[model samples]
Target: MGDWLSYAPSDFLLFSARTYYRLFELYNRAIWPAQILALLLGLVILWRLHRGGARQGLVVAAILSGGWLWTAWCYLLGHYDTINWAARYFAIGFVIEALLLIWTGVVRNRLSFQPYRDWTSRTGMGLVLFALVVQPFTGPLVGRDWRQAEIFGVTPDPTVLATLGVHLTVDKRPPWGLMIIPLIWCVLSGATLWTMGSPDAWVMPVVALGALGLAVYRLSSARGQSGIRHSEDS
Candidate 1:
């Protein structure tokens, strides 16, 4: 027990910071044009949201599920596992998340996209923008190589971030089931970066919290609206 107490989070890291960042560089090189396609897909989603229709939901959901599957395969099982054995477990989680999205969003067709034009939508968009654009610069801002930048569609962190953003934008109550994997990943990723002594360690966790707050508020507002409808019917 004393030995456990003596160890720190940094001590638990098996890879050096250089190795970790270089993984992204190798990964980016391996999957070149896919990043551009992913970014374009992200833009298409935002455009769909801006158009505001129930039909758009299917496209967005399917795209999101595909993105998760891609990350789970190409990034997690294929690449990340070589560096970190735990990535296999992480891949499992991502696979589950992808299936959930497919089942709920594609099959059941429960999700619909139309911004409520409130705090949830605004915050959600902010997250999406950050994932698509701002996140890449974060590593570079810290003097890390641009080749190491994590992109939205391909990388785990930004993919999760963008998914959470899209979840928050759902016309229905935020899907807590769908959110579970992403929320867990956010915390885990943040802590992992923190262990690596990375400056942007707080980013994912903070965004996770913000997404959670917006979800709660959206849920409460939903409940309130339901109550109002019930009263009016009575």
Candidate 2:
């Protein structure tokens, strides 16, 4: 048991930091102007979040669905899986998440988008800004080349981050199921980046913890509200 425990996350890595970042460089070049569209999508999401209605909610869900699908195919399977064997499974997870979003927000029309005015909502908007405007430059600020930057629509990391932000920002009683995959991905991403010794390694895990706390608090409040209503009716 002790022998098995001795292995650190770095010991499991199959590629060098340079090789990993190079994949981003190549991916960025191949994708070209998609990054511009991705940023525009982020701007649109931010703008529409305030004027949220059912239609706007569906739009948000559809955009995220497309982003996940794009990352699943373009970055995960096409790029990262070649280096890491587990990335194919990650791609599967991304696809499932996309479909889930479609099922919940599009097909079922279950998501109710609202402009929540609270601390969670405020924090969520900050996350949205981080994912859209800040995340792309994070690698570059840490001394990596601009070519290696990850964009919201083009890569899994920022897409996942944006999803987290959206989940927190819109729903007064956020969907616990929808939050689950993003939280899991957060832990996985943080571990992978930490293993690679990236300076921004702390971001994902911290996001996960914050989201989880918010989820619990929101759910408890929801249940308490229901119980109060039930008592009053009785």
Candidate 3:
């Protein structure tokens, strides 16, 4: 463990025969900073939403806070192994926050879908898919010399590929189940956009963007519908 800590970021970044070892070392350091920042940013976002009277923000805040707190606790205990394990779980916070923000902020607000959200979702999906599916097939694709790469910059190592493939394939069982929330959000967004003028205005950058846009439109329309209902009730 001490020896692993001695590796430099450059060692992980560069693609060499021993890159896998260096990558493992670098990932340990990298995740801490990223997790910390994500946690802080998520909190700030939640605070803003709460102040703005967004009830759903509470759920986002809770998830992010829990992940951040657990990560911090693991770090303080000097449980590097646990910290590493927690880091992966902490990533769920990132995904959840991103999804919520896209669904609530842009979609609900009827704002145009931006490239940032599309890219993030696509990249995340790709990584998840790679982790779950492509990774497991590595041993069959390559030889037994497969070792996983820990850092992002290096080429796919055998272990890394196998692990990712396996994780993606196993985790995404019943694809419809995994996709239900996003699908509903998309339907709502689309309905809202259709009610508004120009349903076909923007070209979707990706399928995800299209889904997100439709979801947002739906949310905005729901707000409108709710306001009308309140007026009639009053």
Candidate 4:
């Protein structure tokens, strides 16, 4: 049993790099124009955030909720699980995330966005842009076919990355519960990509960690401001 514990994560992988990329190719082809629509929806979310209204925020939440649900059903459960049984568990997590997004961002309507002004907000916007625009180039730039490209709103990695970015741009303290899955997923997906010998293996972990650091910074700043306000009141 101790010997089994020494096994690397790569040893447990059920699919090859070729299989993983091919899965994405097939998934993309099967989905067709949905990708384009998703991209448009992402742009709309960005516009809403820039405009800054509660109705706009609700729309963003609804769009994000739909994205999570779609990824859970179409990618994880419907496709990835066929090759990797573990993906079924991921599908569940995705679904839970979808529900939480709806509950917190839509039903309760707590989420709000602001124009990027601070270093963190600007950085967050950059991450969001990377996920939406630059991320798909990783495959082709690394010598893989464009067919294997993963886009934000389509694939899990970029989706989570973009979500983290959007969270960082929130006008108030970022949603911690909303971030938990994406943070875990970033590490897990980064490890998986690393084990697969992917050229873009570092992106996921770097984005995740960077977002987390910023989130912590924002949280501390909020707390400090609250303390100051309390002291003044007293």
Best-fitting candidate, measured by lDDT?
Answer: 1
* CA lDDT scores, all candidates in order: 0.89, 0.87, 0.35, 0.87
Among all windows of 10 consecutive residues in model 1, the one with the lowest summed lDDT is: 112-121
Tens digits of per-residue lDDT, candidate 1, 73-153, equal 999988899999999999999999999988887888788765657878877977888888899899999999989999987
Clashes of 2: 0
Q: Which stretches of candidate 2 lie over 4 Å from their true place?
A: 1-8, 232-234
lDDT of candidate 2 over 129-169, digit per residue (tens): 89999999899899999989999977988999889888887
TM-scores of all predicted structures = 0.95, 0.93, 0.21, 0.94
Candidate 3: tens digits of C-alpha lDDT, residues 1-234? 999999864344323323323443454465545434443544443343224334333443343333334433333123323323443443343345335434543355321111123333334334433433453344334332223222111111211221121112221121222234334333432333233322231211233354344444444665787889999999
What is the per-residue lDDT of model 4 for residues 182-234, given as tens digits with 9 covering 90 to 100? 99999999999999888889988988889999999988998999999999999
Q: For candidate 4, give the lDDT.
A: 0.87
Candidate 3 off by > 4 Å: 1-28, 53-104, 111-234
Please give the lDDT score at residue 194 for candidate 4. Answer: 95
Q: Using alpha carbons, what is the TM-score of model 4? A: 0.94
Instruction: Give the Å shift of residue 25 in candidate 3.
Output: 10
